[model samples]
Target: MEWDLKVIDELPDYMKMAFLILYNFTNEMVFNDEMKRGDVPTSIQCYMHDTGISEDEAREHIKHLISESWKEMNNENGDHNSSFSKEFVHVCKNLGRASQFIYQYGDGHASQNTLSKDRIFKIIINPFPYKL
Candidate 1:
């Protein structure tokens, strides 16, 4: 898959690495069609397990990137500084296990009922503009 990333180098070091891994996994999974294979592991989950990041950390990182990308894409044209949060979300939903789970559950899933919609709404709508 050819990457046309214009702002990758601008990403924070850790985030850049994470995004690369996520992108690679997304490509591999899509090309291999592994999701159709029963019991096949998603790339995002495999990456977290291999990297030894807690599940929560992996999920948080993926979500953060998605939020940032969305913010950037929705901003006015020529805003190169816009966050690439949507791109991140796109990558994760395409390859990450957490995203897979979310899709599987959908909006009406009881599993998500434990989370407060108010809190999640805030996170989804308001991503930190810059990584600290």
Candidate 2:
């Protein structure tokens, strides 16, 4: 299920959906082996556009996720790692698949305008190695 819909339904409606976006963003970046230490503004925009949320909310949510995770990843002396929550990663993988499907065959539906432009640029600049 989409993280936004799931989080919205599972958590209290008043709860911010940005948390879901941040969770997915951080999980995706780490899982995909990206070097970026934190979520990017472009990624935030994509998540917000996809879920119909606000930019500030998205940034706040990402900060919340990263801050909490940092607490666990850091040692007493304040060290870090290329680590993340497994449960959140699983949720993000599922969310990524759902989002990909929507983008590939959304047919100009709700997600048409919500597609990630940054990702599109990356794809264009560095096309995938193989044809599927």
Provide the clash count, candidate 1: 7
lDDT of each: 0.47, 0.44
Mind giving the per-residue lDDT tens digits that candidate 2 earns over 18-54? 3443454444333222324343345556667788887
Pull out the clashing pairs in model 2.
Answer: none
The weakest ten consecutive residues by lDDT in model 2 span 73-82
Superposed Cα deviation of residue 80, candidate 1 (Å): 13
**lDDT (Cα) of model 2:** 0.44
lDDT of 1 by residue, 2-85 (tens): 565677888653345445545543433242233444434544466578888975676566566555654443342332454656
Cα deviation of 24, candidate 2, in Å: 11
Best of the candidates, TM-score = 1
lDDT of 1 at 124: 62
Q: Model 2: how far is 41 from its true place, Å?
A: 6.4
